[model samples]
Target: MAIGKLFIGRKVRDIRQANGATQAQFADMVGISTSYLNQIENNQRPVSASVLLSLAEKFGIDITELSSGQNDRLLSALTEALSDPLFETYSPSLQELKLVTQNAPGFAHALIAAHQAYRRGNEQLASLDDRLGAAPSQEVTPYDEVRDFFHFVDNYIHDLDLAAEQLATELKLGEGENYAALSGHLEAKHGVRVVRGEAGDEAIRRFDPVGRILTVSRYASAPTRDFQIAIQIAQLAAATKIDQVLKQANFRSEEAVEICRMGLYNYFAGALILPYRSFLTAARDLRHDIELLAARFEASLEQVCHRLSTLQRPGLKGVPIFFARIDRAGNITKRHSAARLQFARFGAACPLWNAHQAFETPGRIIRQTAETPDGVRYLCIATQVSKGSAGFRAANPRYALALGCEISYAGAFVYADDLDLSNRGAFDPIGISCRICERIKCTSRAVPPLKRKLVVDHRVRNPMPYEID
Candidate 1:
């Protein structure tokens, strides 16, 4: 892996100030000269290896805390936000962006948040006339809020994951018997009864605390029944730990807190069913073959793919993966990334992505080696998944699941074995969203890039109506 230069001046300064350390004192503590420390704090000099180690050891912080991943994420977000048409006249240079991101990160993040609010408002009022003149509401939906909270954390909760693993081990919840073990645990530990309801019921599961009855739908698949049991286990047996994590989250609204609570409960359930060590071992041994691993763990395909993205357990980190589920309309209903690729937070995914093609060929894993505008290449594997409505007359929900990793790590995946990854020409060009994508001459582009000009030359005909400037 290539290590990027660390420009964490603001973070270092904040830490020093928070500890009430003066410049000279902090320099002495880190065994650096005051002048060098000042330069480092101002982003004039990158943090040296010695200084980074000293900061981690002397301050008792994780070494990864000083990594440049957060800086890259913030920079990427700020750049994407600036590409909005609302900031057309304010085109800052790359160096200017770097400076703001490295020095004034808080302001940069705030500006990006404001622009996102404006964009959301514009989208909400897109059908109304004079929408451009109206001010955007400064609010974010609870679902989006909770989703971003998980997304930004790389979809990993180390402490909660460890707790789930411990619980699973203590309960001796072996493979193929998760549902029974979990049901027994609920009854023995929390005076709860697990029962299956009629197949006609639409709800997947319902809980009645007063009656101490947990009713699961008979229509659910075996894996789903087991998953629901684990979820209830988290809600009851892991309530104290869940409460602790919720307190740490400090969500703004009660609704967001509840949503985050549910997310955490689901996360715990995944960790419990697919305990970290065993799952990681199986994944590696199977070369990350989703179907094989799913069979081994008795988990759903989506569950397996989703769990792969959350294997960022510090020293025991697995391959960084990006997982997303898109409906037939190209709407991303579920998304998480431990890779460099971040999905579009608004609107549909790029039409060129192989994930969309999964809808065309159901049940088969579609493969594509795609290159984004940023030049990052990925080995993408996608397949369509559907749920039976349990009745002929009802509608069944279907989605395409996309799971991928950076090209550099493609060797670890079973899906990439047949691909010509080294042949750059074989990669398809894709983008995040058409509005901010800089892919010129793309036939599937729904709209022009927000920050680019167009040349309409009627005399010289081309595939596209207008040539992008």
Candidate 2:
């Protein structure tokens, strides 16, 4: 196997600039000549191992920070952006994209911004026919706008995570004491009463601001109850911090700000349940076992999976995972990805993904070696999780949670232990959505690709009604 070159000249330059050190000063500190450092910073030379060690020893910087796989993320984003039908014939090769991401990251980000603007414009144009005679309207949904904000930020709010971690420490929440700590904090700090009662069939938690009472449903699991209490604590204690982050986001509408506030609260809750440093260390030590981690942290499987995707905290980053929750109807209820695989913003997910099959085998985890149309392979695990059972006659609310990481990191995941990673035939090919998928002969395809022509023949009927050209 050929070891890839570590081209971290830009990162080194960035670190030097952040510390307000001149190139000559940094080069001397790294024990490299100024000319050589200049060449390295400009991508003309690869970073040397000696220089990496010197910088680590002198500056107390993590070596991984200099070689973070941000280029891979940029390459994935660029590839996804170019896969749009608008650029069907102008796609760049993987190598070309890597070069752009490595050498000119700003340009790559500019291209992604342009593509996003184009998509927004195209969406507006598609809705033009519905408002032909009416006055022009600017009625974009704030929910979607906020979702895009979180999606673009990779679902990790550094400030909020740190704040929640601090709050958890202040509450002295140790392992298995998350619920008690949060409930006690709420009662003592805010003079609020925490009670569990028969919330109406649909209500999971209800808070009376004036009465300062937080009511949680008795039907909820212990983890859910803890998470609800944490959310209430966030609203009461961290509202100003949440508002600060929302203002930094500069959302267009008040509705977007409100939605983002709730998202930040939930983020705080997740952080409280799984403090970043401890959770990441535990996850690595346990080979990223969701069930074991949930048991250890007193959290639900869904919460663990969601927290896994938000572990992108700069120098202390963890594996980049993608997580999604879908209903039995195949509708994606929640989704986030720190990996290359992105879920479709609209419509149901591809039928071939094991996430859809999770509903059939409730409580049993299913492992899959799946490949996307982009040619990226992932080790995916899926299972059904449920909450809130009303009674013997009422069905609980259930959703399938799918968690995955790139195949390169599969060795660290227990779910991939018995899989044949080397055999190409073992991986199942999947797509983001039927409308955007380019697979011509997929038997499960519900619709033809957007820009491709179709061939229909009455005498030549196969699994699909029409053949894509």
Candidate 3:
């Protein structure tokens, strides 16, 4: 049997095409023969160490990434090209095509690039609208929807704290006993089997809706287990609210609506586990110490950080924050925050941020102050968390989560009180909006923003143009 080579040859080919480099050019740059590079791209030959190392060095990427597959690879380019809202209206097969693109990455790039082009074209048209004096389009951008969600969360404080306290009191989940007790309670009430499976058992938890039972993995940490319970509780308790919010959104597709609903359910789950008011008080009292909050709320450090970002429940807001979780290769896995951060939507994140450094110092909260090109400064707190399977046979790996907020709100918490903000020694300069930023001088930019149109000029004074193409 042939070995399933780990390198994504399709993706590598797409990247080369995107860069406008001929195969010969790339091969020459990597110090390899063109025929050998062709074989690698065609999947007939595995990427050599020398070639992989050269590519990683040039791209400032990890060699491990060049050899492995992503957990959640996006859809392929051709699928994205074929995926029109019009197709979903007429043919259900288009949906299957989309799923194929999502799972099979050769199609992912086509979809992503196509969508990027589609968005850019619309943006250009919108720019022309101002001159024509036409009314703006009523269509809602995904960015606007996300922004509105955060805006609503920033002010809308719910009664989740009271609910959590009451549930804890009623269930006697506090001053915690063994996880087995919770497991037994679940079994008795919901028919769930809290069996300890090997980590990386493929399915960490399986909810049999028909059986009205869930099989949870024993490899989960106490906090992870509690989070699972909280999710179940949220699904049961807040189904109505979740449905209502999703229905009101008028999502373009059923899949989008379902995705949003699941996201909201998870939000509610986090709120249930770490009730807002009490969590806020602890965060303030402990000076934003993550370990203290983790112990107090019986949550993982990453969970607390994620919950802190959502403190934007309108009216009684905590701090406006920005959150991003990235691996060593700068691939962002989970990101949700209220702050105006500039990040590449479909590619790698910026390299200068201190979030990556958190992996070097696991569990300990690291803080840094960053200044955007707009002169806005933010206080970024980041840390690494453990990642692995919950079952004995599981092949779980580790991951990291990095979160931060504006420096103005840092005083509301105590994590960095003794650190001298006046000194500016600990703080590094960074930008939030990477696309719209005109700071062409930045050496760390992985890819140019989608907004900037490239122009080929034979007689241009400068090599790069800031103006739209």
C-alpha positional error of residue 184 in candidate 2 after TM-score superposition, expressed in Å: 1.6
How many pairs of residues in model 3 come into backbone collision? 41
Which portions of model 1 show Cα errors greater than 4 Å? 11-34, 48-68, 98-105, 128-138, 174-176
- Give candidate 3's root-mean-square deviation (CA, Å): 23.4
The lDDT values for all models are: 0.85, 0.83, 0.60
TM-score of 2: 0.84
Best by lDDT: 1
Candidate 2: list runs displaced more than 4 Å. 1-12, 27-75, 93-140, 170-177, 198-202, 392-395, 435-438, 450-459, 462-469
* TM-scores, one per candidate: 0.89, 0.84, 0.60
Q: Rank candidates, TM-score, best first.
A: 1, 2, 3
lDDT of 1 by residue, 427-463 (tens): 9999988988998989999888989999999799888
Give the local distance difference test score of model 3.
Answer: 0.60
